[model samples]
Target: MERFFTLLLILVLSCGLAQAQQKHSISGKVTDNTGEALTGANVYINGTTIGTATNAKGEFTLKNITAGNYQICASFSGFKRYRENIELNASIQNLEMSMEESTGTLGEVVVTGTGTPHHLKTAPVPTELLNSQMIESAAAPDFINLMGSVSPSFDFSPNTMGSFMQLNGLGNDFIVILIDGRRVYGDMGGMNDLGRINPNNIERVEVVKGASSALYGSDAIAGVINIITKKSKRSISANHNTQYGTYNTYQSTTNIDFNSKIVSGHTTFSQSKTDGWQNSPYEVDGDELVETDEMTQNAYLRRNVRQDLEFRISDKLSIYGGGSYYMNDNKRALSVKDYGLFFEDFSYNAGAKYLLSKSSNITFDYTSDTYKYYYKYNQTKEGKYEAGDYQLNSDQRRDDYNLRWISKLGKHQTITLGSELVQEFYRSEGRLQHDEESVNTLSFYLQDEISLFDDLMLTAGLRVVKHDNFGTIATPKLSALYQLGHFNLRGTYSRGFKAPTLKEQYYYYEKRGTLYLGNTDLDPQKSNYYSAGVDYNNKWLSTNMSVYQNDVDGLIAYENTELLPGDADNGIKKRRQHFNIEEARTRGFDVMVDVKLPLGFSFGGGYSYVDAMNLTEDIRLDYVARHYGNVRVGYFHHWNNYHLNVQLLGRLQDDKYYHEEPNAKGYDLWKLTTTHQLLHSNKVNLKLTAGIDNVFDYVDDVPYGENRGTINPGRTYFVGVNINFAN
Candidate 1:
């Protein structure tokens, strides 16, 4: 493996050096119709790979371009595409372009569904996009809540295990989460620690539904969510944001960036703390309500730091690296003694890219993530509790390496080829009797996109994976899109597969009077997914509707077995084991509509319906809701040099069904937020925000351990301030 990588590196460097000697460069600036600078606008040569984005001053430079005649274009979201003809010579060429704002969604660009960039209206596969405007308007504290509030197909609920997340009736174990194209690893009781993400640093979020194993592998059976972070192109820039809310909740973040001709660096530091609240002070024991012995919600504190740097070694070669550290401390309140749950994570990544020419490139990246969980027991001395640590519960480590090559074959075709290697190691003193266990996976994939005609596009992809325990598996996907005037129709079919994790196959534990055991002979799960959708866009309105069905085989779940005769006298000792004994199906439909009304007003809403069932037992799936929806309204006004905006958001859900407990009732929630731009200047900007959540002060006081319709802590108010400076 080492020799192979060494040889590839040598080949890439040689090609880059040869190409560097005979290339020219292009420089330009992009602006709006009013001659105002437009930052982050993309400027590229048509039908080629040479491209770059405009800086803070709306200036861009595309280096290492071969001398030729090409069509140069500039594109930005909510703006018309600008094109110009140019001829490159031995010297650098400079130009300027202007664009006009549009009221349609056709200008948006998406990259998550296909692993290649394309306009949202022309993408063969369906994709959902949420920009910074929507994210900020919602004023959500974390990623899970942000998604749940904006998307009808997504749902979240707080629990003792963690925050339970479901997408189209599928659980978190089947979903894949990515940050800037890299996967985020670490889960506590089947839930990922979404708090580690810095919400203020996000630029956008993209969602792709149905199976995506052909491009990402394994756990992408349910869907994929990719988060893109903010980037600055100024010489130096800094931002500070702070928020204070009810229940002693606080959040603050600081970001700094420095960019030069050849080197750029970015850093972020953030902290969040919340004194959690309980809606109920009672518990249900069979048929009676009793006083609660423990707090329903636990308080938590989190701190995180991240840094990234990039070096442009000539125009044809660039190297980048980054690392992050995050820690969380959770406190539980009990009548007897309070216990603590602590978590720590450390991650590092590095990557390099080599541009083969104007239309091709090869890149390599590596990442390592380590996560640790600890339990602390407070000791009682005299009349007070002292801080004392107890045991290390679990430790997990993951390493990944990827190499990819992308090229434009001709005017109407593009190709992508990639390979990935992943390694995982886990140890748990409470669940596993052994010291540790590990698993490895290797995958290779190929994808092709063809522009069959002016109004038709087709995409095909395939992936082959080899796992240490599951042997070999194959996944395939096909999609097509047809555009007619202002409407687009798209369809897709895909296959997905998932291998059992090491912990799921070897761990054993006892909880709440029940013993659970894992089976080493478990079979891998597989699924077939089908989807169809239509999109309509015009100057004033945009609408989309999609329907999907997923059929899964050999699903893994815990089943109750007979109790041992020797333990019958002690109590009702039930035994549970993981088995692949059930087949399941989930079908859903999603509809969304947005209209831009007159007088700086906009209205939008969405609805989702899901039917999840266990075919083997003819029963409804647990934690799945049949119907859910959201509505949003906003008004924006600008006077003189100040801007003001107001937004109202509401969410409603139908009853949720479960097999082992009572059904959860339906509920409604509402929120109102107002933002004011106090100052806007050439070098600095300041903004303030205030909001009220759960405006009606509605609360569900259901007892602990039972399903609750809503977990909101009634009416809450918050205030926030943001400051930015650039030079």
Candidate 2:
């Protein structure tokens, strides 16, 4: 494996050096409609990462540009995007760009369904976009709540194990989350702690439903949530945001960005603390089928820090690296047991990309993520540890080495191919029968896109994977899109597969006073997904409708099993074992419409219908809501150096069904937010925000043993302030 990587690195550098050619530079100035210099604005070449910021004089320069036809783009916070095509056969001394002032996301660029970038309206797959405007309007405290309010197809409810999250009807195990095209980490306790992502630093959120394994690999059967983080382009820029809300909650985020002739650096620090609330106080004694806790929600404190740096090596070759640290302390206040849950995570990534031409590139990346969970004692104990001691529970780590190449075949087609090597390691002090276990996998994939005509395109892809235990598996997908006037029709068909994790095959743990055992004979899960959609877009209105269905086989779940005489060590009472369900499926339809009204007002909403069933038992899947809807209204106005916007969001859901646990009743939630731009300029900006959540004082006061639709404490108020400085 080491030898192969060395050879591949040599090949990449050789190809890049051989393709070297005459270099040219492009110098341009950006301005507003009134011909005023728009200093600190961003300028870049479209479809590439080469970019820079305008200086105090509103002038920007991009060097080492080969002779070719390219699209140059410029962007600013309050101005409309600027795009223009230019042929760079020789050095250009002066290029003037004038941008309009508007805030709309209909023309935003999105790249999640496919490995390539595309306009939101032209994507071959039906995609849901949550742009920065929507994010700021909502003013959510975390990623989970942000999705629950902005997306109708997504549903989440608090659980003792973890938060139960579903897209359409699929659980967290079948979904994948990516930050800037890189997978963050695997789920624990069957759910991901989305708090790891910094909501204030998000640029946009792109959601692509249905199976996407052909292009994204495993854990993509339900869909993919890709988060794009913000990037500051300036000699030196700094921003700080702070918020104070109910429940004794406070959050703060700070970022610093610096760039020079050859290097750019970004650093971020964020932390949040909340004194949780409880609507019901109850406990399960014994010999009961229900699980309960003394408190409905536990207080938590989370902190995270990240650092990244990029080196532009002559524009043809660039290398980047970054690292992050995260820690969470969950305080479960109980009289009998004075202990809390502790979590720690450390991750880092490094990558390099070499441009073959203006239209193509090659990339190599490596990542490592490690997570550890422990029990922290609040008081002194008689064991081997004392007060404030941490007893390790579980430790898991993942590493990946990926290499990809994208090249243009001709004027009409583009090809992308990649290979990856993955290694996973799991260790536990007492949860697993074995002390440690590891798995290795290798994957190769190929994708092609053909522009058949001016308004029509086709995409196809295939992936083959070789796993150490599950052997080999394959996935393929096909998609097509056709456009006529202001309407677009799209269709897709894909297959997805997921191998059993180490925890499901070799681990044994006690949860809620019951022992759960793994099964080595578990089979892999597979699914077939199909979807079709129609989108209509224009200047004043936008609407879309999509219907999709997925059929899954060999679904894994735990069930009560009798112990044999030979299994004396495996207790016979209060035990369960993993098993396959044979067949299951989910079908759903989603509709959305947004329209602009007179007097600076905009109204939009969405509705979704989901049907999830287990064919083997003819029953509804666990913790799935059949119906969901959302509404959003906004008003924006700007004059002089001030801009203000008011936004209102509403969410509603039907009853959620479950087989072994109490069903959750539906509920309604609403939030109102107002943003004021106190100051806006090229050098500095200041913004203030105020919001009220659960305006109706709706609280799910169901007993602790029963499933509650939401954990909202009631009507709550919050205020926030943001300040930015750049030169």
Candidate 3:
């Protein structure tokens, strides 16, 4: 009895000691030179489970930290990491940090389509990584603007309706878009309109500069873009941001997040509006096509809401689901100024994922988008009645479900098996309502990545798909990467295809009593892509380059037909027929360099040049830019909580047409930004930024027959403040 009482007393004393405050909590925020919250910034103590991620508001909280002198570090993409020593007190302590932009290691990973994740240096395909640092450097209102600053090989034209992107001079439809590795089918319009995507909800963007059809199937002949969204990492989180920019434009975003080991979810809300600009004076002279009274601005208002939920059913099995609602009301001066091109779009999506095992997982995903457009025409002084008023309504809905399995079979072997089923329906209503179409696709794919040796890796994949319109199509890819000393070399060959758009198949309309026709017979286009690249990384410098060629078949073109309108009173129906060309070829070379200099300064740049042509037309394809380049430089001082950055962008394409008139000799844009920490405390940060788009504001003659040209945006400026309040 005496021994038992002694043991009980010892247990009671241990419990009493545990109740005392032996461990404290440390938390704070991290910001960039522009006072923008940085996500994915890693924070941790040397060796402890007491580490936390910065919330959406850039605030991080670490609990159960033993009171002692410890070293804390914070790191993010495209920026230098921060490390400091702090003394943890019995009470809560604040340990704030500021990171500077640096070209070194940008410390990024890329998902180069095909479900392959690898470090940028070791990726078999040349991939580009754009993190929050690069996105903020551009100060763009939407994803379209952000691409101009982050992607050197990409071209983005953001109209009020939507934003389109092109890579290596390829058609916009040639690329594939994804959100967190799930297919994100864009609008029915020609361009995907990336502007519809809210940038605030994104964590990073990954780009594969060459064909990715080894996994993505059609619409991946040119390249692939994967947008990674934010994940729940905080116990509770909330963020709000509002911006007023030049040209009567405003943007607002808000998000709330909650995360724990067992349950996690996030909610996001955003709104953006613009009152457009006028360019009537620039088109005053020459050419009957140029109207002096022309005044137009691509104005639009957009709203989006999204929610994500994740549940950890067990140690080996997890489940996740998410849904989003997006709406856009857009107005444009199409055909005539003040005619008012109006469009409304609504889209929703829900998806779920299941963890089959430690090394394998499966996902089921679906998305639907419904959209319509209305155009109103006012009376024209010319009695000719040239202004045609019409309402065009279209509905495009796609449902896709896919199952993917991944296994790390051995130390040197990783295998993936996947199958996807997709159904697309498109219907249009104008003067006449066109019948709907259902295109179904069933695809099966298998990929193997094997480590041939200590320094060599090989990847082989094959995809077979059966489509309602194209029958059966097969694509195969082979790639190998060799690591030799400090340099890595990669070679790849891939095959891809792009299906015909619905408009090319069964589109028909009656304009002013003139009946238009659509071609029922159309063929899917196929392409073969080849790429060779190398990357070199050292302590202070890193460089990568790739040269690629694409051979395509069945290039679609519009030809003038002899068929004339039977109704003479009605206007002629512009006939755009679908026919296949024998051959089309495109070749390009791209290069990127990152340099880390002395005194906390770093710089990086990229360049891409493409030459594309059609054998039948013997001319460059429309809307393909020949040259693109981008560069950035930054200075970081973590101790003082200060940073500075400068960025430049350029684009060039000589050929011009109504669809390609924006193509001009390369022009340069410059931007500058800086952040200063408050002397009193580190919780408050002030940022100042200024940029001159089209720095020279040079005006050039557009390909408007004989009319003078227009000028791009002149200059813009911005200032912001960031604050962090936490335990």
lDDT of 1 by residue, 370-420 (tens): 988876666545654456755678888988888889898877988889988
Quality of model 3 by C-alpha lDDT: 0.64
Tens-place lDDT per residue, model 3, 455-554, is 9888888889888777888888888889998799988888887777676677665533334455667678898888998888887988889888988887
**At residue 269, what lDDT does model 1 achieve?**
94
TM-scores of the candidates in the order shown: 0.94, 0.94, 0.79
The residue pairs that clash in candidate 2, if any, are none
Note each model's CA RMSD in angstroms.
Answer: 2.8, 2.7, 10.4
Put down candidate 2 lDDT per residue, 619-650, tens digits, no spaces.
98888889999999999899898899998999
- Compute the lDDT of residue 615 as modeled in candidate 3: 71
Model 1 residue 403 CA deviation (Å) reads 1.1
lDDT of 1: 0.81
The numbered model that scores best in lDDT is 2
Q: What is the C-alpha lDDT of each candidate?
A: 0.81, 0.83, 0.64
TM-score of 3: 0.79
